[model samples]
Target: MVALKEALARNGGLWIGCAPEQREAPSNELVMHQRPDFDIGLFELEPPLYRDFYLGYSNSVLWPALHGRVDLIDVKPRYAKAYRDVGRRLARLVAGAVNDDDVIWVHDYQMIPLAHELKALGVKCRIGFFLHIPMPDLQTFKAIPEWQDLARCLSDYDLLGFQTRRDLSHMINIFRNTLRGELRANGTMGISGREVALGSFPISIDVAGFRELAASGADKVSPPPLPRLIGVDRLDYSKGLPQRLAGYEAFLETHPQYRSRVSLLQIAPPTRDDVDAYKAIRSELESLSGHINGRFGTVDWTPVQYIHRALPRTELAVLYRLSRVGLVTPLFDGMNLVAKEFVAAQDERDPGVLVLSQFAGAAEEMPEALIINPHDPHDIAQAIKTALDMPLSERMKRHSALYAHLESHNVTRWSTAFLKQLTSVERIGPDGVAPLPGSTPWSRTA
Candidate 1:
């Protein structure tokens, strides 16, 4: 939301959001709210449609499949129907509101069918879709119900964007191999009798803004008494919170000297409390945290601090600055901004080490950091030790390189690059289908 708002603030555009839940069905009109630079259009959906679409199909099915947890998928015939219904309704609202020349950019998995629905409604402006989550491997993605239907909807877009080269490849391969679609001589995919453009535009943080926030908050918040290993994420299965806690436990058991001297603080704000999978993960985390503390914690010294609520971003920046290690080990992630934010919120002279997961999208850009397999507790434990024992000079060198890369590929640059590519795709005419710029024979990246 912040990234989109920032982009629209600079180049004014409309933002659409669903309004607060209401007992009665809302009128077809879209509620309007004016911002300084852009306008927000709010609409309301009937309760059942909202629930089945947002929580049922989007979160229950697509979320699990995208995160590579096929076992967790909850598919119902009604869920898919409601998902399409919501898409069709939103398309009608948008079709009536926007002009034919306006560019429409749909975001995330929830609205994958938006472009197809809009096209059906004869809304001819160019449409682009960007997935903010990982595109699972072919087998895992195929596990989702109505997988082919989703793929067809995706191919209707003028351009499709992903967060990493790996994700882009997974998607294109799915289209070609599974859908039996052909790759054109020129780089576009010939699917459903139309061509589609694809690219990987890795998203990024507002580096300078985050750095200043950390610096400003440093004096307001007190530093930890002992060396602190901080992990901040939403309480979700994909975050690997249980694995992280188990790793911390292994660290304490393997190195008894630091048992009471060091601490691991995990801040996981709750999300999707209504989902069974989310509830299960929360219960597991609570049990794991309790077990770790009971095993190693003392009356005076706590080994693990588990926080279930969120902290203000300013305060989080302060905590990041004071921590000795920033441990981000997600099972799978599109682009974990917390890892980048931790790097941004550091004291460069005696900077904290970032022990990141190899599976995280951020790891592709930040190779200087200590990367470990998130699935292995022993690997995470050893990586933590290495990060803590690293020399000050080495820490400074790694931090410098990481910070430099962040500055070069900051969020502003990320948004600008994506918009530029979308514009180029639009110029290819009404269909907005052309060979991706700088296309390779089999693979492509932007």
Candidate 2:
């Protein structure tokens, strides 16, 4: 969202999204903010529509299924219709603002079908779509009753972006299966007899700004009494919070000597509380945290310091700096930015260890960090022990490598690459230029 705002400042556009506090009626309104470079539109939905569109299909069906949990598929006809209805409603609001010359870039699953709707309404501009989350594996995606329709809608875009090569490959394979399109060797597919460019541009944080925040020493929170291992994620099932707590318990059990000397500080703010799955995950996580704390707590110390709230970046940076280890072991993720942010905020003089998940997209980028299976508590526990026991020289080496990569692959580079590609797509217009594909070239502009 920060990068989106910055891009809007550079090249103006409107951002329409859902924000309940901005509720005037069922219609979207332009948000007049301090920054005049861009416009923001917020719409409030009716209760049943909200329940189905957001909490129902988007979360219960698309989200879990996309993240490789097909059993969680809760597809209802109303939910699917609600999804389409919301897309059409959003498209109606967007239609008033867009023109033939403007580039229409849609984002994520909720807005997947918006481009097709816009095209149907005769908005003849180049449309691009980027999925921020991981694409589902072929079989898991097939579980969705409307998978074929969704895949067909995806092919309507000129270009598609994924966070990792794996995700792109998955999409291409799925397209071959569902769209019956021939997949080319260079990651293009013959979708409706035209080539659609597929590419991966891993997302990143503001590396320099985060490092400066680390340097500022502002908003520093009081570190835990023990040598802390930190886990920062939104409270969600895919984050593997329950497994992490179990791993922490296992770590305490297996390594009794470090029981009082070490602790896990987890900062997980609630997300999608309207959804029952999210609520269930929260309950399971809280139960696990309580059980672990009860099992391994002293009069003056606790084994886990779990904060169910968000923190300012300044404070988070300071916390990242102070911790001895970063535990970013999500069960599934497109790209875990917290892993990079932790590395970026580390003190090189006495850097911390990062225990990352092999399943996370960031794992592909940073091989130096200790990687483990997020599903296995034993594996997570073992990785924790390894991180806890890793030498200073090794820690410094890993941190330096991860930091160097983040410095080059920061968020600015990501946004620039996507937009530049979106603009440079092979449109049948006068300026029929194309961007260098495969991966985005790293940019170092201020």
TM-score of 1: 0.94
Which parts of model 2 are misplaced by more than 4 Å?
A: 22-25, 28-34, 218-224, 428-446
lDDT of 2 by residue, 1-446 (tens): 66566666777787777766523256564343434787777667877888888889899899998898887788788888888888777777778777888887777888887876776676767788888889978888888877766786787687899989899989988987766778777656765456677789888888888878986773345655678899999998898889888888888899999988997899999999988888899888888888888888989778888899999878889889899989998888998889998998888888899999998999989999999988889998999899888888988888888888889998888878887887776643222222222222111110
Query: What C-alpha lDDT do the candidate models reach, one value each?
Result: 0.86, 0.81
lDDT, residue 124, model 2 = 68
Q: Which regions of candidate 1 are displaced past 4 Å? A: 184-187, 426-446
Which model scores highest in TM-score? 1
Candidate 1 lDDT, tens digit per residue, 250-363?
A: 898898988888888899999999999999999999999999988888899888899999999988998999999999999999989999999999989889999999989889
The lowest-lDDT stretch of 10 consecutive residues in candidate 1 is 437-446
